[model samples]
Target: MTGRFGRCRRIAAALLTAVACQSAPPARAATPPDTTARASGVVTWAASADRMGEGTAGQGYRLVVHTSTGGSDLRVRFTNAFGDRPLTLDGVHAGLRARGAALRPGSNRPLTFGGARTVTVPAGAVAWSDPLPGRVPAGIDLVISLHTPDAAGPATGHWMAMQTSYTAQGEHTAEESDANWTRTTGSWWYVDSVTVRPARPASGAVVALGDSLTDGWQSTTDLNRRWPDYLARRLTASGGAVRGVANAGVSGNRILADGAGQAALRRLDRDVLSQPGVRTVFLFEGVNDLKAHSGVTAADLVTGYREIARRAHAAGKCVVAATVGPFKGWPEWDPAGEAVRQEVNRFLRGSPDFDAVTDFDHVLRSPYDPERLLPFFDGGDHIHPNDKGMQAMADAVGLDSLDCAR
Candidate 1:
């Protein structure tokens, strides 16, 4: 009787132990999951292309571009958008400019397309290089080298680069010294966009989409004196989230017609919408369209402005319109064009369609003429602004207006 009683007690204890084991919670993971990954990219530099020029069969181009924001995973885009045939690049490289055509030792790194050494871009297409590992800083010249073994037809490139770049014969893309890169050119070829992954995830960029004035036509070359450049400096110094500035201006580019390049309306997707992390579109065009005397009316220009605003807003971006600056002294200026300009400026100033407006007309117009550029700011053509005018235009921008989400 004593043994049986002991067995029963053991069984009851075993049942309770099993119940406790089954009800216990599972152990938590030792490592916590990453919750702070950011996907936004900032465009450190850019130039807009209008047409394709002559293409050299066995040549290399050493392009120099200044960056506006610092970040890691540098990337570059080469475009053949205006070409009529396939353009093949055998090799491409990127590096920090130690000086004029010379690169910082150990900084010249080869860039690949999908891990391949060569890439051929089809007509009307663009290619992006795989992200390069390392950090690229702000306000420094970044040099890119490209070797085109076979290129022809319409060569897409940006005319009036302002900054000087190097060129040479054969495959000299691997060279760091300026030895083989003797020839110089003021135009940027194939390459159009440079982007970087910002340190902060939510950081964004602003694109200045306009014409010659925005293109820094007469501003001191290689000094980065464009209004957008000034704006970039301000954003960086202020430690704001919107630090990237892309200059998407073509000299003589218009808003309604496809003259200098494609019109602002036609190239909107490629130039503005497709850019990575663009938060605002600063529309400062129309002077060219109005002054061209192309039979464009004030109503037509206004309609174009509204279309731009609508497209940008649809893409979840802010649209900031700028009133057309005075151009009374320009050779193309006439009473009809001036009237149209005044009407367009008035609409921009009061339009609710735009998220915000900057009165460029007020800032650039002379107090005396009211329809002519300020003498102190004019670049002598009486149309485009000089360095001082560019600075003033940039200063007129309210930084707060640029830091907005849709």
Candidate 2:
């Protein structure tokens, strides 16, 4: 009996040892966080800057602008490009617009430069604000309130905003109410561009380099009805990879000469290429150059186009050309200018210098009279198109072509 009990105990011990000797399954390595969609940054909204007028010290500007693409980490760029002296901006805030000169409750936030609320931009230079936390939705009116403590000399701003902004005598940038902002202005001060970090790293922006037609001069004021605005809406709705749109148009701007503003060629670097994540440069100017009878032949205009294309290509950006629309009834229109326009259109249609071509002339011309704007689309100027015509032009753009590789 004793021998049998000892043998049973040994067998039990052997079974326990066998179970402990077996190896356990290895634990799975923790899954790493996905960062493929994280974006570096992209320009969501922008306007071309020009010399507005003399700057007023202690004056606050509540500039309202429409955003094209939505994202987080908002940033603003202030320009002193045309200033002859250093521009000191003490207070700046950005918020969602509730109404005229009023911001939505809890939306107004102070903007900083290098972690400070104040920044001094040197003469003929620009400054970019540090990124602000929070997300901004697309197609919304963004109100930027800023105060210049020592803004003297020439003020660098966009002259024709179409949208009305407000002004106050003191530093009213922190206030969300419109009571302090009693004065109205038709220009955007200092601030030129706004950028956001999109969810997709592949997201990019397109800058429309043109004249008044692209600037929404004839479209209804306060409404974002420009062709570039329409294009932005279309891009958002279509869920395209290229979603941002920056309008770099100036009223009466020319391609070859400096008149109303710096020529398109001269301002290309500051107005278009300098914007973050710019994938394409959409060239649509030339009408003003030909209509002015500045001895700018089709060949000369084509050379300007080629130079723009070459510079854009050097910057690793795609170039898209648009044919000039018809304007037979315009006072500037003449047989000589019409001939130049036709020749330029032909070259734009067949040019290999551009990655893509948009035939704006074909889209805007009247079927009854090919040399004139469609009466339904004309804004009564025989040159600029109304809102409907602007939408049509935006609709005519091929979404796929905008994503061309450089």
Candidate 3:
């Protein structure tokens, strides 16, 4: 969240009163057949079009399907974060392609819904495709195609998805007979997750909430190492005991006001409230407020965090707050801002709002400067953490709180 740009930033400091959030009714107990063994969850990678800017190329924007030689549902999520006008979608489809560089539409498959031809996405809106009614057996490639009205920005994503989604394309199950998959990179516009659930009793989910740092800009393509990914690896090591992590970081997201990515308050609905089976949240945002925004103070950051906590508590979910790590020597660091960072860290460490507390700042900071990042952990930019540093973050947290329904 480098405060280098000029935009309204649209930080939804005020909550959206449109949707009444009463509460998620308690999940019903599992039946005799569906045991805790069948539980599942999803890890969602989130980002806004404006947040990525023109930084990333779309070459990496791809949706890959991996099934166990059986048929499964293909679900997708589309975003209109940068859409200044109505996003007119002519076609949305999925297909299979070969492994060569000339990644033309490997094969052809059409993704359709209720047999409709198009979907118009409103500005700043997200649309999910109904689960494909088909099944994809294992050992195959399913590629989702998105034809947008304009070019994507900041970065593109090419990764294995966790949830089921629908693009403008129709049912992306094993049946993409009329669709096509191609080799492309960069310019990925938005992100989503997908999964298949049969007669499962429960699912587990991780909430990774933060700014551009949490979004993982330059780390690597499709190699999910954005801190939360590391935590996912840890969970996987637990052997299906933990479900998955859902990422809620927006690029350029700040704690106080809206500017870069939708500010923390504005996106709580789309990122947090609307997530499926979310049980825990990891918070490592706010350095941007201390460094980028000029009028921000400790009180403002605390107030914003308190609101986040209240929302999480009301949802019966656990909130893990990480101290704002050191960023004193960043290309954009301000000395006064450093003071505010320290002050805010003090409050987060002792605050009762968070159900749990993690010391990311203390673990990733340099001993020499204390206010700068550890040399090895720096992702060149003093703002974000490197892969190894991200792994350290996972190790430092008390992940036991996410025990699956045993």
Maximum-lDDT candidate = 2
- Ranked candidates, highest lDDT first: 2, 1, 3
Runs with alpha carbons beyond 4 Å of true place in candidate 3: 1-72, 81-91, 94-110, 115-117, 133-142, 149-184, 190-195, 198-200, 403-406
Q: Count backbone clashes in candidate 3.
A: 59
Task: For residue 220, give model 3's deviation from the true position in Å.
Answer: 2.9
TM-score of 3: 0.70
- Comparing 1 and 3 on lDDT, the stronger one: 1
Query: What digit string (tens of lDDT, one per residue) describes model 3 on residues 9-46?
Result: 12111111111222322222212221112113232233
Off by over 4 Å in 2: 1-40
Each candidate structure's TM-score, on Cα atoms with residue i matched to residue i, is 0.89, 0.90, 0.70
Error of 1 at 149 (Å): 0.5
Off by over 4 Å in 1: 1-40
Candidate 1 vs candidate 3, TM-score winner: 1
RMSD of 2: 16.9
